[model samples]
Target: MGDAVGRRPAFLLSVVVIAVFGLLSAVANNYGTLLAIRVVVGMGIGGLTIPFDTMAEYLPQTQRGTALLSLSYFWTFGILLVVLSAYVAQQNFRLLLVLCAIPCILSTLVAAWFVPESPRWLLAKGRSAQALDTLRRAAHVNGHPDAVSLFPLGMKLKAEEPEVKSFAVICSPQWGKLFFFLSIVWAGFGLLYYATIMLVTDIFAQDPAERGEADGEGVDIDYEAITMSVVSEFVGLTVVMFTIDRFGRVASQVFTYFSGGICVLLLCLFASADSTSRNLLVVLAFGSRLFMSTGSCVTWTHTAEVLTTEIRTTGHSFVNSMARVTGVISPFIVQGGLPYRTIGVILFIASILTTIASFCLPETRGIALGTAMSQDSTTAKERTGTPNSQEMSQSPATVSDKEVV
Candidate 1:
């Protein structure tokens, strides 16, 4: 839908869906009602790729990696805020839901009023006038009105617009290889990321000494452990934000996954030895989280960067959907009473496989976003010294525009 219509509309619709459903969830009377509403909320959440795609398209290539990775700070802070809310609400589920909805509502207003449609999407869809106008507006905002003159008044994509569905285009031979490896990376990260967090929470729950008595009330939630986990995420994001653009996406993922897998292996060893050192377990858990957080951030930014603008949102959403599937299954693995070593082996294998898969993907650190699938195919062939006659014939202006933007 984003690729077909425009990124801004899809983004606005997503925010509205989340805000409306979230508020509705606050008033849900029963568990089933709340669950159904949350499903709709999840659908809204799924469309979040639109905004990420929008940001990726609008930003300059030099700053794109750092900017996109920086967005992860909001996510980390959001988690911290949720934890804080949960602590404050103290079982008042209604208040908690309302509090969560507030951000969605505010974001909806901001997106609707402030955010502009992606000029890249406009150009891809044969709306050059709008695309140029958007660029002019952006240039004006940045106090570079003169740069608007550098943008072509009536730009056209060198590659023809794709007629088939976005999915069909990405599934074609040209993009299929990249998509396949990305899917594996996303699914593995999803499974390992959530599973590690849940496993850590379960471990904390098992140690009653960490859980204080609450008289006749419910068991005290371990907010301290949760805070530590969030802190680890922040630390990981801090490191990746500085290094991702410098090292490139593939290298970042490889490092994080390999290091994280080692942490998981150590966790397995500690569990198998039946070590009673709670502090050691906590440290290992934090270490796993730090790496997982960094790896997941790189995976997301890489996915957005690699796909062509024509299929950016669709391709990203597909890979993210695979992640969502594994995310759902993570709870069962962690809470299913499986032995620690078994869970550790599953995560370790996933991390290592993802690490290997990261090598299969091309690095997309500073490359301008490809407007069409053919551009991507041409680039790939160029890398392999097999550029076709048509790709070799593209005009200098068309090529220069890609680099300039």
Candidate 2:
């Protein structure tokens, strides 16, 4: 687990990625330009998430869930902004895109100006004096007790003992396990979630040859579709927020994943018929979005909490990046937005990935950040020690003194 100290970089990284995506979107020209920009954008976004998971391990256990939930509210507000724009700002989507970028860039600047470095990272690096100062700042902000209890650990005294590895190390020995699993799971999550939400438009487009037969209002505006988007995007998130607190993390996530899969299969099976299929697809789409959002939101909460504090930003960045990468591809695949039977197949595939990944992850509803990192079993952990013990022992705490050799 990490302390408030460990959470700093991840937050700062998130701010940077958000701004970068804005720049990419602003500059993108063609489909290919947008695609390449998205990949780079995804990686930068991915880099930002490391701190959330890591910070969970650092705080007092009772508050971890609450803190994460509050963090989620920030994300939800971003989504809410999108929903509002889509509903009210009909003609200026491009401007909306640019506006999103502005905040991200501003966020990065604010982080640099105001936010302090993570005390945990300092301790892990063996910068005791610096870490202690950070610790005081954390307590002052949160009104927590002055935690002199920070472990005796420090970064290696020599500094050269455990040099941070390069990307090749992330790939070779680690095989980027964190990155890979997160990518796969996020692929499913993104595809499933977005597909469920957008399937209405897909239905309209797919059956457009029969547009004369598409609507009830006789005007063809497809109000059911517009209404569904609103209900699912804005109203549903607000509704789920309260339930999230009641249901907790694991239960809410799995329930959403399993139910979302069922919703998709139901839509495909029922919508196979012609006449009644359209409206039914709308209803099913709503259901899927609600359930899928429930799962997706919960997963975000879980993932951000489950990783070790030390590597939280790295781990979060990887997963989040994967989600964006998939989002970029999902549209093309689900509707042959490419040349394939993307929708049904992609949904099932996503279902399986989330099911498998969800099972593999450790449950961390109430765990502290410090404990989480000490117990981490990733490449760094086997090389160092468990996350909990490490937090207690002193991390990036002592390089020369605790060198593995």
Candidate 3:
């Protein structure tokens, strides 16, 4: 949808549609009504990345990775806030749903008033005059009036691009291996991260023995464990925010996944010990959550970086859908009739796969989104022309303005 309609409209549509669905969901009368509303809500959710696409267009190359990763802070914080709200409100889910809609409505208003359409998308769609106008406005907003002239209006380039099966393009010779690797990394990490959270709740639940052993002396539920896990995730986000621009997306992701995998193994080993230490278990869980959050942030940033703009929105949707699939599958592994040790083993394997896949990803540190996309498209063409073509060096970043209209 972003490919055809442009990011700004798609983004606004997402927010407005979601807001509408949120309100409807709150008042849904039956399971069937809620289910129908949620399916429509899911379509709106697919456009969630459109804002990121627009954000990338406006940010400096140096700050782009951090900016992308920072989006997760809003997401993670929102999750924590909602959980706390539910706890405080005595689990009034319907009311909470209504409340969430207000923010989406407000955000839609802000975006409609403030956000400009992406110049790159405009260029892609052969709307150069409008693209230049958009760039000038952006430049004025950024206090760089001189930069406006750098993006000439009506710059022409090849106007014809194919729209094959989006998946086929992603899997063609140029991007196939990289796409596969990212899919594995995304799916595996999502599976383990979500599965671990479910497992932790079960692990820390009140023991039936304690409940039966005394009169009104059952052990208090350690809600602190949940708090600690979320805190660790925030800490992880902070770490990524600082180091991602320095160490680059690939290194940070590899370290997070490898270290996280080790933590998972340690958790399993500690569980098998004759004298299991609760403190140690909690510590390991915290570490795992930290790395998982960090890695997840990196994955989101890197996936955006690696794909060309031509296929970016579609690619994001595809990999994100895969991650969501894992989210669905993970509960079965962790919560469905399975031993705790068996669950740990499953997560350990998933984490290891993620670490390995991270190794296959490219470093996209300071590359401009537009330049990266063009470079990859050029490489794809060259490779198709000659199967043995040596990898082409990245061309000097240039803005072409001379092609025929």
Clashes of each: 0, 53, 0
What is the TM-score of each predicted model, taking all chains together? 0.86, 0.69, 0.82
- Winner on lDDT between 1 and 3 is 1
Clashing pairs for model 1 are none
Evaluate all candidate structures by whole-model CA lDDT and list the values in order: 0.77, 0.57, 0.72
The candidate that achieves the highest TM-score relative to the unseen native structure: 1
TM-score of 2: 0.69
Lowest summed lDDT across 10 adjacent residues in model 1 is found at 390-399
- For model 1, the local distance difference test gives 0.77
**Model 3 bad stretches (over 4 Å):** 145-165, 207-210, 213-221, 268-278, 370-405
Each model's Cα RMSD: 4.9, 7.6, 5.6
Expressed as tens digits, the lDDT of each residue in 1-405 for candidate 3 is 776788888888988898889789999999999999988887888788777876765566656877788888888886677556545554467888876776778777998899778666776777767766776677667787575465554455433233223566777887788789889988987797887777666666665575675555433556677668778888999988988766667678778988887786687667656588889979988897889888988888888777776777777778887787898899899779777677777788888889878766665655555344333433323222222222322211124323443
lDDT of residue 290 for candidate 1: 92
TM-score of candidate 3 to 2 decimals: 0.82
In the range 269-312, model 2's lDDT, one tens digit per residue, is: 66655556556777777777777776776677767655544455
- In candidate 2 the C-alpha lDDT for residue 64 amounts to 52
Report the lDDT of model 1 for residue 270: 89
Stretches > 4 Å off in candidate 1: 145-160, 206-217, 268-275, 371-405
